[model samples]
Target: MAKRSNGEGSVRRRPNGTWEARLYYEDPRTGVRKRRSFYGQTAAEARRQMREARERLAAGAPVADSVMTMQEWCWRWLETTVAASSRRPATRVLYESLVRSHLSLPPLGQMMLGRVRPSDIEALVLRLRARGLAESTVQRIFIVLRMALEGAVRDGLIARNPAALVRPPRIERTEARHLSVEEVSALLECARGTRYYSLLRLIATTGLRKGEALALTWDAVDLDRGELQVRATLTRIEGELVVSAPKTAQSRRVLPLAPAEVEMLAAHREQQAVELSRVGEWQQDGFVFTTETGEPMDPRNVLRAMTTAAANAGLSDVNVHTLRHSAATAWLEAGVNVKAVSALLGHADIRITADVYGHVSEAVSRAAMVGLSDSLREPPRD
Candidate 1:
């Protein structure tokens, strides 16, 4: 038997030759009695562990509680933290879907959050690879998990963030394809009589993203000034269309409309007015581009329309975004400054514009040298 210290508790030697140590203290914050215990073959080891436990509790560290599973914490993390962030709605929906459909399964989701190790995350990534997920998607999952675990650490629910120790899969960049001048002309000619003629012309002339184009409203268009303001975008989230702020602050830009594009948009507006009047009870969304009933157009539907228009135009497999690339490439070929192009495309940095359009400029420079040589070799015909 051992005497209790200051009426706290005792470390006593049991009959089986093992020592039992118990401590009881009232929590300062909760005012509730808290108890802990340690067992050891020696009283000294038992007392040491017990003292360490008490110190840990006094330091405001989390005691072992009900184990929080990964699936449980992930839902709470999404609902309570991620859903309230300034991220675009599409991004939030994608994160939620990725967690639910892929991450919350089997050994990974069933594991306790506190007990999750780096090896577990690495294994999850490996499993994703084996399951044929793209490296980019796997990397995104890693990022989402890292963010969720970081939130847990910030909330003081976890002692350490295991995600910090795991490495994300690497992704390789694929080269973007741009269209030729003749191809752009042919595509524009094909869109001449279609319902989306103005929309196609606008995108071909300006390098605005698909979302930016869809979110355009009549208020953002200034025909008098020959400009269009890009302040918001329409994106699909969980199969629902949502209008939200642009992905980047730089993405909110004003693009100058070509003369032909402005005239085409004016004609299209008149046609849309007639169509809206015909459908008296249809939804009247204020979108610049809409379905016949004035409802917002689905982006995927627009993509399909673009594809059909391209095929009809005698172009093979040219995507809608290729129109934007063609616009940038054409401008670069015509001696536009990279900085101006960067501003037109709403790129965060001029380096991005240069990286994508630099080759076109190089070809232009080569042609310029050829022209200079031809002029010098004119033989002074006098």
Candidate 2:
């Protein structure tokens, strides 16, 4: 046994041959008594561990606590932390779905936050991959988990976030499908007699998204000017149709309406008037696209109508969005610049327009080459 006069510590072996050391000091900030212990079979080992503990306390390093589990911290994090931060309703819903569906109750959540290692995150990702989740979805889950643990680190709950040390799975990008001109014609011809035929034609010609088309009002259309104003979109939130601002600042746009489309819309408006007349004192909403009862058409119903029209046209697999792509392709083929096409499609950037529709420009280039060949031909000397 060794003891220093200044109240520094030493280890002593008891009669039972067990080595133990006890050290007492006052907390520098609060002047409270702080006691620590080290136990080992040999006095030397106990003394060494006691010295390490004292050094760590002096350095203000955190000691790992076995009681602090990931599950506990996550609950506290969601309640005390995330609840205080303002997030969009849609974003909050997505976060709740991810946490409840994937992360809330698990061996990973049960493990102490400090004890969780990078290997644990890797194993979790493997499990997600085995369950048929796409790499992108698993990567999103990893992001949510990392953010949650990072929050814990900031709050002094954990020493470090293990999730940050793991790599997320790589995601594969698939090219978007666009309809050919023939396919577009076939689809339009199939929609001929159906109520939504004009709607499909409008989508194909004007490149209006389904939401934008559904949100159209009679006031926004200028038949004489051959233009339609896109100022809002009908989107479903919490299972109810809500009219909201355009998806992006640039999404509000004016689209030219062909004379034929104007006529079709005129006839459709007449039909809607007759239907509204039969409603007998019902309030009339001035939406250009609506149900027979003069109520705004649900975007889902518009999609279904388009799907049925495509099936009748024998283009069973074509989605409503394919019409928007077809319209962009048509404009590109007609020599519209990528920037002009980007504006027409309400894309945030011309690069997006070029990336998706640049292939159509190849036809324009071929036509130009033919024109150059004809103009460059040399006349006979005579």
Candidate 3:
């Protein structure tokens, strides 16, 4: 008998000149003790396998066998680690989409859990790019694969994460499009007398994200204080509308209400009240924006409303985000402090504000230069 000093595992000669190695451990997940065995033709080979298992166990890693396929491990990881965790449903939905559409396919998926090599991971990236997938999408797919393999490492299924050794595709950042103040005002006016008028106007005035605006509740608004708090966001998760906390801590914030928005909201509230009165108990509450039936506004309908208004206003390619950017652009161009604008937009960092509205800053600088030159010019009478 060749026994480990810790008495956790042993290698022994078996019947008919073969060798068997055994490691005993407690299953943390199941809370039960279990035994795992390995076999080899030579005692030395059996001992080596036994030693690897013991080392993994000593390192606080699970001693599970790596016989599962990559596809199997990925699903297990999704169901147990991602879905079962405390992550938002939207995050889980994204992970699910990525795993199903990319990780659980073809040669990589069918391979053994520990069989993936760095080269195989690199080839997957190349194949995805060959299919003409956007670099961002390809980068996202690679991240899902990497996350799956990292789970495998934790479960003792693989010693190294091959995806970690591969480089992901680089993503190019495109400049965000936004409307000018005049265009935004025209869009708002076009949407006026329509149900989405107030919502669109609010976004342009406050730079609130569509989700954050839709998620706004009566409790979060203070008409007297002329303020509103962004506490949650309403988004679709797996096709079901869900109200969840803001995506980032900075996203949960308080914003001052411009006088125009305050008046707009007051009128909107009155209109909403009249509409809800007719709903006859089918009415839902706690949402600032709602459907005719008083339910939370479906995100799709919100888009339709916005697009219709944009088309009528002769604004092409305007989306919900355009309004937010338009508001930020207006703030930057009007000489508001960049930091103040960033806080108003609930940005995690001021740099993000500067990046998106960098053009606005340049324009502001040029205007200031003109003003300075004019003021410093010699008087004509001199």
Best by TM-score: 3
Stretches of candidate 1 off by over 4 Å are 1-35, 38-66, 314-317, 349-362, 365-382
lDDT tens readout by residue for model 1, 179-249 = 88888888888877776767777888898888899899999999989999999988877678889998887
User: How do all the candidates rank in terms of TM-score, highest first?
Assistant: 3, 1, 2
Q: Please write out the lDDT profile of model 3 over residues 1-382, one tens digit for every residue.
A: 6423442877788878899998877765565767888899998898888888777677766664487888899899998988767878888888888878878898888888767889988888888889899999999888888888888887667767888888777886666688888888889899988889889889989999999999999999999999999999999877788999887788989999988788888988898888777777755566899888878898888899899999998989878989998888888789899999999998998888878777755667888999999999998894
For all predicted structures, in order, the TM-scores are: 0.82, 0.70, 0.83
User: Ten-residue segment with the worst summed lDDT in candidate 1?
Assistant: 57-66
Worst 10 residues of 3 by lDDT: 1-10
TM-score winner, 1 or 2: 1
lDDT of 2: 0.77
Best by lDDT: 3
Worst 10 residues of 2 by lDDT: 57-66
What are the lDDT scores of the predictions, listed in order? 0.82, 0.77, 0.84
Candidate 3 or 1, higher lDDT: 3
Evaluate residue 354 in candidate 2 and report its C-alpha lDDT on the 0 to 100 scale. Answer: 74
Return whichever of 1 and 3 wins on TM-score.
3
